[model samples]
Target: MAFITKTHQEEALAALQDLVAIPSVLDESQAKPGQPFGPECLRALEHTLALCESLGLRTFKDPEGYYGYAEVGQGEELFGILCHLDVVPAVGQTGWKTEPFTPVVTDETIIGRGTQDDKGPTIAALYGVKALLDAKVTFNQRVRFIFGTDEENLWRCINRYNEKEEMITAGFVPDSKFPLTFAEKGLLQVYFEGPGSDQLALQAGGSLNVVPDHAEYQGSEAAAVASELKKLGYDFQQQGEGIAVAGKSVHSKLAPQGVNAISRLAEALVNTGEFANPILEIVGNVIKEDATGESLVGLFTDEVSGSMTLNVANITITPESSRVGLDIRYPVTLEKETLVKALGEVCAEYGVTYREHDYIAPLYVPLDSELIVTLLGTYRELTGDMTEPFVNGGATFARAMNNCVAFGAMFVDTPDYLHQANEQWPLASLYQVMEIYAETIYRICCK
Candidate 1:
């Protein structure tokens, strides 16, 4: 029997619309004492908690505004469903049919920043719990919908939540693909710094996890670089003595899908012999058009987690120095020490300093585990998908704890627009996930 009905879908849709309307992108400038993430993120958290409370569930908002949860049922053991309220920045992105934050509901889909990534799934899971509660289904364990505020940046909210809250026995995060994700690659965010040229100033890209879509270089050889860009058929504009190149943007996890403007600009500068030696060495030797780590350190691959991927996500050049940010997703079989050693050698040879910003160890749950079996069975029973569980390069909340993995919200063979412009999710897919969540919650918590 379907656990989610038309009324439930309508309610969930309404809740998602309200949540999507808030531009909950993290803003460091708006950070305060209580809301360390930012004002918009706090508002999104407060709104979600309020909605959960209105649904007759007990809720908790961390005093420091790091994380929050909505709870139902009563038991010593807790089963968690983790989701996030904050979204990636969409302020200056292009190709949106409407405003990025405005919820556009069509006959088939809901389009917005968080619609596909998390906010829609969060509301769907909430209503799933609401359905179970409305039906008066008894449960032997507690169910919690944990919400984080800094998922797009660092995972501070989840870290803080674990520090203060009770540990959940088993759980799933609805932020990845369906048929279950049993393994995830390790994540490493590294930064490289080197001396800069006084004759050139360069800046491009935004987040460390996104491919640079725009870049500009201003200096003595700007005109030569601009002429080279014209010959290369790039869309460029002259700004003062600089040239700005526009390229396609994509998630760092899929860096090969987009043209990185930073790399393009570097190529132009190198061809014109205007870039500094350090910059020339790093760009011409370390980074390349391909996402594979072949040109940087070395390539690592495994049967379970696939190959290593490296993305040059952000770059900035000033009169004094230049910094290049890289996002690397490595396979589980590789040792962190070995990778770091190789990177250090490369940096030393290029006359640059390297520092790692964040590191997330790989997550691999055995396929024969009870949690994986149960989630896979539930997905198969609901959607009849027989595809085997797979691995990915992206990190999720599931990596924060044991006995947890990412389950559903995205299905097999579906086009992923999670961090891209015109982010969207099918309306019917929401109801489908609602039914699956309700069944899984009932099976895990009630039975």
Candidate 2:
């Protein structure tokens, strides 16, 4: 509250409203040479960088459309505030009271996609730095806001940024909740393939990071599958020619909290005793309803980030080939190869060979580091909250750099609506978050 004013709050909120108005979801169909992720992501990046320039910061838009940045101050040490513009697709997600892309502002809240995920927080941090600059505060280190374009997908944008942009001395990803996050679980996405049976065909789910909400299969063998799902007491519905098995959808990192619709369907199919797909058998018999990697005999558990979680993200089966995708978040202290090897051992029994689709190594920073100390001190001084830094299965831009961690955008009471239906931001927290960022930046970089 010290650095930001009512006028500044109005300006910041207006900026966020304008940003949330854009439906900047990843669209590969409109992808071109310079716009690798798609036109929307490129547009979002361009818009965000332009906003930064409008705020009187030096800005640069990447020619390849993978990333962008805005900066102020001059020093050998560079402080980064990592943010992303691209958000998860919101069109099909249920439970929206207003249009997902249309920013609906009330007296106390703003409802829109990307509001709480990253965009709203990004604007808060931007104005936070702008506050110090406007007050003519001299920075002892360079402060830069690195805009990422493909954070919801494979992180190709930030990967391109790391390949092309200058590395920061240290920073925080404004994309996550805090006190602060000191560790993150390792993320592993694997694609398993096996021989396909011409007798059956199936396909379900999307976005390797989101657990499917409904496995509505509308193909061959509907009656049998439905009968089995009913006998199994699974939540499902009959969809004319097929059946839809219902599951609670959530981010893959929080798989323990969600139900895997794809797995549900697979279980029903296997129980039918009519389907002979090896992949389906594995999903039903091997991994059945287990989020804690219990199928693997608890091979992936650690004290820092807790037990490994698995989500049957997607599946596709055909006569030519059978494929299934998995999203696994292992502990930071666990060995990746050991877990990978254990998975392969079990999967190989069904003639299913596994290949890693993507892998992000875990992130860990000591609680006593200068960056942690400064950010934590700033947060405590502002809120009087003594909650220590913690770890989770979530992955953020904090993994993009060595000295970075995820600092608070959400306080203790803020519900996490990131990547969820009806994502929203509380208006009351905006000024406080901006003030926190302003103060944190001052203590960490300006001083």
Q: Which candidate wins on lDDT? A: 2
Model 1, residue 419: C-alpha shift (Å): 5.0
Q: Model 1 TM-score?
A: 0.72
Please, what are the lDDT tens digits per residue for candidate 1 over residues 1-447?
Answer: 567778899999999999999999888898988899889999999999999999989999999999999999988888999999999989799888789999999999999999987998898889999999888899899999899999998899999998888888999999988877878888899998998767667777789889888888867777899887776676888999778888788888777778888877777777676556675457644575657777777678888877888888887778788888889888777888888999999888888999999898778888889898889999898888898887872578999877889998788866789899999999888889999999999888988
Q: Pick the candidate with the highest TM-score.
A: 2
lDDT of 1 at 68: 94
| Stretches > 4 Å off in candidate 1 | 88-113, 191-299, 310-327, 335-338, 341-354, 413-424
Model 2, residue 177: displacement in angstroms?
A: 2.1
RMSD of each: 5.6, 5.1
Clashes of each: 0, 0
Candidate 2 Cα lDDT to native: 0.87
**Each prediction's TM-score versus the true structure:** 0.72, 0.76
lDDT of each: 0.86, 0.87
Local accuracy of candidate 2 as per-residue lDDT tens digits, 126-152? 999989988889999999999998999
Q: How does model 2 score by TM-score? A: 0.76
